[model samples]
Target: MSATEDPAAETADDFPAAPPLPWRLDGSARLGVFTLAQPMEAPSTVTAVAARRLLVFANSYRGGDVSYDALGVATLARHRHRVAVVPRHLWVDDPSIRRAGREQASTPSDPGSFAWSDSSARIASGQASVELSWHVRTRLALPMPMTFTYFVWDDGRLGCIPIPGRATGSPITMRINHWPDHFPELAAYESSLALRLNFAMTVRPQRLIDSK
Candidate 1:
């Protein structure tokens, strides 16, 4: 689906009623697999300097091995790009949302809403450091917390990092599911990199913006 599509078009009634509150996966079951549909293209406007200001937040499910765990969702919002992978994490956190069988607590006391805040600072090297606290609703009725820190440098590089809370469960699962329709290209990349590994994504824009 296009990112501009109305989310309301896919309502709860469209799918079977959520199976249950807290879905559970068998400890020994084999996780599923996914492949990226395409490569992600950097926005034309993203410069080396602006790239440093970019931030990304992602959440993955632990099934068997950390390297092969399936990525549940990932989100990035910059001056040029606003993307959500498996946006359910941005709007809802029920186990039934993705059929992963795991549930998180809720936040804002709303079943399908979230709250967030951002802060920035100037470092000694004259670069800017930014941080974002993104909370998602979960079965615990509490926020499943994910923090992201971004460091931008004069040379034009951005560092994106994710720090998940303690309650976050794990051992990465091999298969990833529920790829967000808004970012089919990114989904394809994630699917191809099924193995668990920590790496930074760098984007160099040829143009500052796409008029299209």
Candidate 2:
């Protein structure tokens, strides 16, 4: 036997407590991280870890690259979430629908011009998860016959799947018990760096709600 305590036996008390909600990052370098508050403007730094905390404040409603009046989300190593920010593009290809065009104020009817909003665990499970959801208001038509996908954390592994109904709407539903064993290496590479969201909707949704 040695005369030292086992380092692995340390309890929660051994480490410093985590900061409460709306806490500052303090001094961590925000290089690859991004926060979207508008579709055509720039994203503001809500919390910067430069010193203690960098709290970003805004009242413009919309400033980042999103389609709604207000667009904002928090991205961190631990978690992330979003509300009212529609995804402009999807990195992974889904077999449910075909790309018509891109989102634009000029080409409203072109499918290629529209991006389907999505959800995230961080954004939905606010306690300690990334809950991402992009609301498309009551005017624009849904991307009918589309499928949304949600990618969960795989201990730094890459993966993708259909967005569950809970993350999307009542008519849709999905569940994932474990991570895929063989996700494409290309996607896995990106997952190691950051979390991304992609959504699919009907080009003609019957009941678009203004949850905002």
Global lDDT for candidate 2? 0.20
Q: Could you give candidate 1's per-residue lDDT for residues 1-212 as a string of tens digits? A: 12222444455555544333232221211112333344333423332322212112332333322111221222233433422121122323332442211111111111222222221111110121112222222223222222232222122332222222222322232322223334333333222122222232211111212222
- Which portions of model 2 miss their true places by more than 4 Å? 1-39, 42-82, 99-206, 210-212
Q: Each prediction's Cα lDDT score? A: 0.25, 0.20
Across 1-212, the per-residue lDDT of candidate 2 in tens digits comes to 01122323333444433222211111101011222222222123111121211111011112122122111222211113321122222211111111111111111110111122342121111122122222222332233222333222222232222322211112212111122122111111111122122232222211212121
C-alpha TM-scores of all predictions: 0.24, 0.17
Identify the leading candidate in terms of lDDT. Answer: 1
Clashes counted in candidate 1 amount to 26
Return the lDDT, model 2, position 1.
7
Question: Which 10-residue window in model 2 sums to the lowest lDDT?
Answer: 101-110
